[model samples]
Target: MSEKIEPTAAIEGAAPGAALSPAAQRALEEAAARRKAATAAPAPAEKGGPSGPEPTRYGDWERKGRAVDF
Candidate 1:
């Protein structure tokens, strides 16, 4: 009968490097910069301003003339 072999024996090629390639590194850096900029930028004011009346919870229901009263 054949015996079980070590898992590593199944692998036949050299291991891949842990480091990112130059172009990949640049792309990763750019993505990180864009993410940082997006989060750092001030959020745009809501359409009617910060103090505008709160939006209805069920805008679609209101449009359909449906209401649930407790």
Candidate 2:
């Protein structure tokens, strides 16, 4: 099988003083926004799961690793 590439392969491909193109920058921003939006939704629970009261505040659930109420 072919061997893995070195980490510096991409750095070697670009010109010494080159900067990211506008198209490339825009693509990166779009990808980041999509990722954020996708993860912003609450996770779905299975049937007959622990259904309970809504959280009072975000920081309350977030303080614990799981978004669950104690």
Model 1, residue 45: C-alpha shift (Å): 1.1
- Please provide, for model 1 over 1-70, each residue's C-alpha lDDT reduced to its tens digit, 9 standing for 90 to 100: 2543222311213134434444555565677678889989998776733254443654423323655353
lDDT of 2 by residue, 29-50 (tens): 6776787889898887768543
TM-scores of the models, in the order given? 0.46, 0.39
Q: Which pairs of residues clash in candidate 2, taking residues 3 or more apart in a chain or in different chains?
A: none
Report lDDT (Cα) of residue 51, candidate 2.
48
Q: How much is the lDDT of residue 5 in candidate 1? A: 27
Residue 19 in model 2: shift from native, Å?
A: 1.5
Residue range with the least summed lDDT across 10 consecutive positions in model 2: 4-13
Candidate 1 Cα outliers beyond 4 Å, as residue runs: 1-17, 49-70
